[model samples]
Target: MGADEKAQNKAEKLGGKVQEGLGKATGDREMEAEGQKDQSKANLKDAGENIKDAFKK
Candidate 1:
């Protein structure tokens, strides 16, 4: 929920997007799947932070 966590989550999401793009370009299905999973995990963490922040208000 803190700034560091948010930054890390954002970085991870960006990395996942890059990975997915690279995988698709190279025709690597496994890599694409992994990237999607990473993106999902990052999104879930972001959602959790948002929920905590909302409760704090």
Candidate 2:
């Protein structure tokens, strides 16, 4: 994966974590679920990137 993608993924993951924390603090179930979803999507993207890079190699 490129540096930009890596950075984006990292940022997204961190944002998700922050969102989750905020949700928990504010007692918002919807926000917590959205945060989890975002984290899962980011993780999937990272996994896809790794697969693509492996194929390239």
Candidate 3:
């Protein structure tokens, strides 16, 4: 994966973590779940990009 994609994925994961933390502090189950979902999506995208790169090599 390119640098931009990697950075974006990292940022997304970080944002999700922050969101989850805030949700937990506020006792919002829905927000916490959404944050977890966001993190998972970002991780999946990163994994997919890595797979593509491997095939290219």
Question: Among these predicted structures, which one has the highest TM-score?
Answer: 3
Q: Against the true structure, candidate 1 has what lDDT?
A: 0.93
What tens digits encode model 2's per-residue C-alpha lDDT throughout 1-57?
Answer: 999999999999999989988999999989998888889989999999999999999
- Root-mean-square deviation per candidate: 0.8, 0.5, 0.5
Better of 1 and 3 by lDDT: 3
Specify the highest-lDDT model's number.
3
lDDT (Cα, tens digit) per residue for candidate 1, span 18-56:
999989999999989888989999999999999999999
Supply candidate 3's per-residue lDDT for 25.
94
Count clashing residue pairs per candidate: 0, 0, 0
- How well does candidate 2 match the true structure, expressed as C-alpha RMSD? 0.5
Q: Which residue pairs clash within candidate 3? A: none
TM-score of each: 0.92, 0.96, 0.97
Tens digit per residue, CA lDDT, model 3, 1-57: 999999999999999998999899999999998889899999999999999999999
TM-score result, candidate 2: 0.96
Q: How do these models rank on TM-score, best leading?
A: 3, 2, 1
